[model samples]
Target chain A: MRLADNYEKNGDLIVTTLYDYARRIANQVTVVKDQGRDWDQLIDDLVTSKYFGYPLMFLLLGVVFWITIVGANCPSQLLSDLFFWFEGQLTFVFQLVQAPEWLYGLLVLGVYRGLSWVVSVMLPPMAIFFPLFTLLEDLGYLPRVAFNLDHLFKRSGAHGKMSLTMSMGFGCNAAGVIAARIIESPRERLIAILTNNFVPCNGRFPGLIAMSSMFMAVGISMASSSLVSALVVASIVITGIMITLAISWLLSRTLLKGESSSFTLELPPYRKPQVITVLIRSFFDRTIFVLWRAVKVAAPAGALIWFLANITVGEYSFIAYLADFLDPLGRIMGLDGVILLAFILGLPANEIVIPIMVMTYLSEGAMIELDSLSAFRQLLLDQGWTWLTALNFMLFSLLHFPCGTTLLTIKKETGSKKWTILAAVLPTIVGIIVCTVIAWIVG
Target chain B: MLMIISLDQLPVGESGIVTVIDAHGLTRRRLLDLGLVPGTVVKTIRKSPAGDPIAYLIRGSIVALRVNDSKQISIKPFSEVAINE
Candidate 1:
């Protein structure tokens, strides 16, 4: 009669008991338990909430940017001193060897100085920033960031995953392009690739950090100033983000289409990031690797810049004359020809814009000093700059073309020349237009 | 019922869990590679002040995606289906 009740085999109490225990063990030990009984519902409810979720995300974002800005300062100054001293020694060695004057000009003045900027300016911030950023990633905070903004991304007609890719863009646009591989729609992926230049990469960050600190945060309290500069960069980054959204919206409605994909997002429990592991991975995997890549490209670029500055065709070298030619257009955008030239040359690396500009303006064939941020500020002003100039420069820098590495990365990821070209060109057009409009309005 | 976001409408702080892995081809694989499985949670961390490819966190990694691409995802809150407690 009990057998008629089912496959229970009720008379076999011992076997039944063992079966129950085994099932319990399997559920507890082998599988991730859904103690989350209605986890799907719980996640959905929280993600969709109109009030609490988004503000928390903004608070976190402000926190991250604040930390990156604050943390990057002291080390930046220290690296600057060490590299400058190295440059001084290298200069003395060149003199002792009785190196040809032009040889000195090319290697010591042009190449080494550029390398120093790359090393000193680019390294510290990345060292301090990447690990901290990685800590956020490790703690499972980022997915929740995407979850909170999914609705906004959807309305913009872009893929939600673009949010994640763009975050990578802040570290380095090339990495960001690689990150774009996360978008599930081909059209959406294309859009992500095209728009990623909006975020300031490490190369671009020096410009942002230099300008914002000089112009915006000159006299604030010790702690306040750092936070202010970061907020400023984040502000530009936020603008780039907005533009990315606007462009994607325009693309999807007109060209790309389909729907936003539905995917599951899991927010892992927050854990203390293992510091040793994080430092090792970030230093080896990201910081040093990026530095090495920059150096490989930068050496050739250094030679090119030297040649461009020194080789005179008529009264000016090819680069100088070209900058002269570009000046009118640059003026239309509230920038001058030299700045435009710097952007074009800086395509190989954004890290050199300030140095290039100083070299071109000073006629010293290279940027000379790194004593203080104030000195950098003085150099820009001496070259016909104003607050409008600084503002426009920041905007253009924030919104301009992807650096050479990023462009190549886009090519690698898309495996298509057409998409890569589109990625490079679209932002330049937007940058010029946006900067021009602002320059006109503010002028 | 599920609502589709046009890339432009996604706000700075909104959050959503994936309801469909609806994108096709390589793009689909791209999402999956970032641990964006069908049941994963997503949150918008910050929008650049100018807005566009807002930053979002997926799984444990931070990724920035454009608003247009987010349009492909069709999501509805659990609260929409269940009575809110």
Candidate 2:
């Protein structure tokens, strides 16, 4: 009988017998090295231990987020100041050249500000995060991460490799979707691609951080406030992980029904991470690439937002009308129309969501940044945002649709528009349901 | 007499020689690629918390196999002193 037919006929017995036969000969011929208790074994004992594995994973995740949040602040401020200065110079030149009001608004207020915001806000985190992540990958910790999570994934009827891709989603969901290619099973890969959006990416960090600071850290000291913010974000991340597992299990049972494919993951030896090489690779490959994509989508969206906010239909601008139209629905979900409109308009890039919200609130001709977290909190309050609204908003943001680029990435990865549409629709439906439930309870 | 036991039934820290991998298609190919071919020795390393998937050391690498998949492969048990060279 042929191998394929034999597999169909005898099921698993043939494969096991073959391996058993191979073992018999190998024992007879080969003199295997008995490196009884190597360093790799020692480390694996702790990392893959049933007890400590998961706690260590969560601890490491918290550390990474803390470092990214604290480390990005100074550089983010410096970049923001520099970019705003450059924006001022550009506006002055445009005025000196007597550029038309519309052209000045479109080019300076819209495109320039959009690009600058994305770069200043996004670049530092990616610069910090990607290298740190790559260092883990280089040190062989990531696979052990896979090793540790393997059983949970297996229990969910999903591939063990989903753990790695989910971690990749932290930097960028588009990259995470692309990283799903590492999984050989097409079914599990689809599951990974569809669920990658649950984990908020670097682009969503500003909004998450803003909300965390304004609401979560109400009375904490400045030193511990950032720490509190980090913890809030970490818990949200944990929530995202729980959701991912739940969704993965759901998908496995319903849409992508098949036994999870088994594969051997060779845990590579831990080595000294080549710092210079990793830095250059991460800087060029991850930081620049993700920043460029965000900037590309953000600039056009920025121009559109500026036009909508500036062009008045009688007294209220188009954006105002949009917010008004969305207000009733948004209220049902414990958010204002302006907040909903910002999320809708910020579909191109998540990094712009808070800025769009700030612009909508200020009703300024351009997106504006508050000088401090207190001002941001006051602004949200003036918009009638309660604690419930903040909680639901964060949950909604965490569960909503992926940005345009990520949807495109899903389409390309899945090669089926049906799956891509499902990817876009699934989380959005969940987000609405979750927000509504929360809102109803709070009310 | 040839004493055969399923790989999943093999106790932790005990080594066995693979005898029969009764699986097919991609799964069968995967097992072979992971050096689970006949004549190779595998030792059950550890189990996760929930304990369905067990880790095994095969060809010097730790490969995790769920009980469902691992149970299909049969192995011949060997004493540790037999292979101590």
Candidate 3:
């Protein structure tokens, strides 16, 4: 210890010295082989080039989202059909046993239907999206994405790697919050965590896609409607990214004031993505995990929603009373009371927000699955939805508070109650402010 | 004569020998740990779309550094004549 103290070298000097020795040893022992062509450098040259980089990134993102939206439709329809068929069997079994109506309502209508709705609606897209995203990650493109978008993040006074975390947010916000650990600096990591909710996760994507498709349906060709909807969803994602940057800038300058930390991102060589491995890994690790959480939350939420729609007050159901109480505030945000109530009740899991709203609107004990986007749009239109309301709903969904799982993740990650609450409040406030302004403007 | 310039100023596709890393604390340590020590040959590979952070080849690995951080690294460019020699 005394000898080390006498040497008095700083950490940087020690690392430099050690690397110097290692480099010298490697130079002496290793034989050089000229591979002639460097594929990695060639790829990086194009990928990280100033002109092609941003366009390639956006094109890749658009293609992935387009593929996910188009590909999941058939499987989602099939899954819904299978589940509802099972529901029929369940109904038969209930009648055979002569179960009470309340028991039937709670079990077959409430819990089982809710679980099926989540699985059928959420599973197909998630199963498709996660594997595609994981393929990019496995191919080492994500770090290059961070590399490409670092300048924007740096301008926001946040670490560059926040881009990586934000991309993870597209999968799930809880996972995104966990991904913030890659940002070594505490202040910037918090910024990443707080701003992650601005990006709509997979849970909210179904709603956004449906709304965009429904909105695009009018005055557009059938073939191009999906393409336009994908573009609309992409634009919503861009809006979310802008909000993320703006909020990150606000937090860094105001609450979490600090200079942005230095980070060195190693752009790894792209490898041949293992197709089967990526499929299986993303299936179990992300899709199944998220589906399980959504199902767990959706079951009880379904039961509660069923009760709310069934239990009568004076003239209306309990949910109607709650919606009436929130109608004024919801109107200010260009949404009805039931919409706001759905958001609140759907806090446990975003996958059920639309289902809850539909159940309330129908005033039915069970959440019903519509056969087509037009049917869903017809229901919303019957409820007096305008373009303004649809826009504001998408905006609100994009900017609202993180779900319960994400809040818990923020709490566990930051290990501070203050930050966790701030994480929840900051976005919710932004969401409310944005929604209200848009509503007033449209009005 | 060799010209000394900040790493951030080295044009893409140019090679230079690192002279000094004028950063402090963790940043400096990270740069050194990535084998950016003096006398190491570094190549400016590509710039991001925004042209602020640039990728560099150092010790056979590609590492990206933002302009603010990369400016702290000083290097001596190898002249065309020197490369030919």
Candidate 4:
């Protein structure tokens, strides 16, 4: 107890108790005989093999994404239904009390709706994604992932740890920026910090999910839209991965020009993942923390969104006015005011886009029943959405500037206002360019 | 003086002992912790597009180290020179 206390209180890097535990385990670990082995050549043969290496890497990536998509669906729907039902109950109770109309609207519609959306949309996916990702981290597949891409990164003149940072981008760009510390080179780290936004953060996942499900309903079979949405989400994530590689390559040659640093990667031994621990750790550390942040941010955001939709200026609400201002830019990208409005309000969290869009569109249509996917489709049809618009929206979601939280994180991570601004703007530029080009060519 | 050599300059399929560790400080410690030591037999595993940081095999595992870091460590390429005349 005293030793544990000392370890906890002291300013020390060495975790003595943890080291002791590691040492105890180390004794039982027989050193794999260092026979006259040529391990470097062997790993080289495997990773650099013209055919096998990259294909294998892609396979692993697809498999991990597939797992995330397949796993997160059920709980997301259930949570959404449960929360909405709870909201109905609150409204009924408030109505019975004869509470002031403004009080009920402010409390239930503004705050409760926002918090419920945060939990339902963000929780299920993160609950599944973070633990699965933590499993890979625990198995040390990340080092191999870095090893696989090190040469490419070197060619780009970026530090190898950018590979790991990009992987972190899968979960959250903010965390990905934080992971840049693992790269010791300041120049390379800067390059990573700048391009990290190319890998879509969690805020964009909802947009990806909505687009994926809506378009993939091509087959006559009845598999449900959530399943299709999940697939689209996975593919969009794959697109984000491709963009990271491309941008990294671009930066290496242009802004950060230097020789690539070569370094060895050590694959830690794999262990049987402890399920109970994974659940506890991931739930409290990741899902709940994100949920809490979303809830906090969503309160003001929801109130503001409510205010904008409610308060009108000369025949148009604040939202409509803002969208009108952004309409020209939106039109150039083949999107209209409503879509642009959704993206703007989605700055707090991507998960709220569908809900917020539903609310706004309902106001425009005078009604919308969003209980299921079909009704949602009807709402979209009411707005005259097309395949082109959906495609553009997804591309914008994947490529645009990150959410407010992620921007703040980039600022904190880089400690340079200039880079932080670039991190946000570079991707916005890419989104607008690619989106514009596609909109033009497709049209 | 200029020393700009591509990673392919290294003999393919030949194993060499690591002599130095040159990379990011975080990467160096990570490599060291992974059992990369001077005089350890390391075989090149793979090369990426344009080939600079070549992946290597050491002590029954795989690692990727860049050409510059690899160059810092000299190697006596394994060879058999048989003289039977």
Best by DockQ: 3
DockQ of 2: 0.44
Off by over 4 Å in 3: A1-17, A24-38, A364-369, B80-85
Docking class of 3: medium
| Cα-based lDDT for every prediction | 0.70, 0.80, 0.84, 0.67
Model 3 residue A168 CA deviation (Å) reads 2.8
| Model 3 Cα shift for residue B13 (angstroms) | 1.0
**Candidate 1 vs candidate 2, TM-score winner:** 2
Task: Give the distance in Å from residue B68's predicted Cα in candidate 2 to where it truly belongs.
Answer: 1.6
Q: What TM-score does the A-chain of candidate 1 achieve?
A: 0.84
True-contact fraction for model 3? 0.83
Find the candidate with the highest TM-score and give its number: 3
CAPRI grade of model 2: acceptable
- Best-fitting candidate, measured by lDDT? 3
lDDT of 3 at A177: 96
Sort order, lDDT high to low: 3, 2, 1, 4
Q: Is the docking of candidate 1 incorrect, acceptable, medium or high quality?
A: incorrect
Each prediction's total of clashing residue pairs, residues at least 3 apart in sequence or on different chains, is 95, 26, 0, 18
- Chain A vs. true chain A, TM-score per candidate? 0.84, 0.85, 0.90, 0.82
Q: Write the per-residue lDDT of candidate 2 for residues A183-300, one digit (tens) a residue.
A: 9888899999999999988788656766776688777687887787778877888888888988999999999998788755666667788999999999998788778777777777
**Could you tell which candidate, 3 or 4, scores higher by lDDT?**
3
Encode model 1's per-residue lDDT on A1-443: one tens digit a residue.
44533332332233435545655676787755545425533543454355656555555556666776677667777877887888789889988988898988788767776677677767777787778778878865676666666666777767767878888887788888888777666888888888888877767766776677677776779788877776777678678778888888887887677556544344454466888899889988888977886677666677777888888988878777888899999999999999888888777777777667666665533454855566667877777788778878899998778787788888899899988888878888898999999998988
Name the better of 2 and 4 by DockQ. Answer: 2
State the displacement of the C-alpha of residue A171, model 2, in Å, after optimal TM-score superposition: 3.8
What DockQ does each prediction reach against the true complex? 0.06, 0.44, 0.73, 0.32
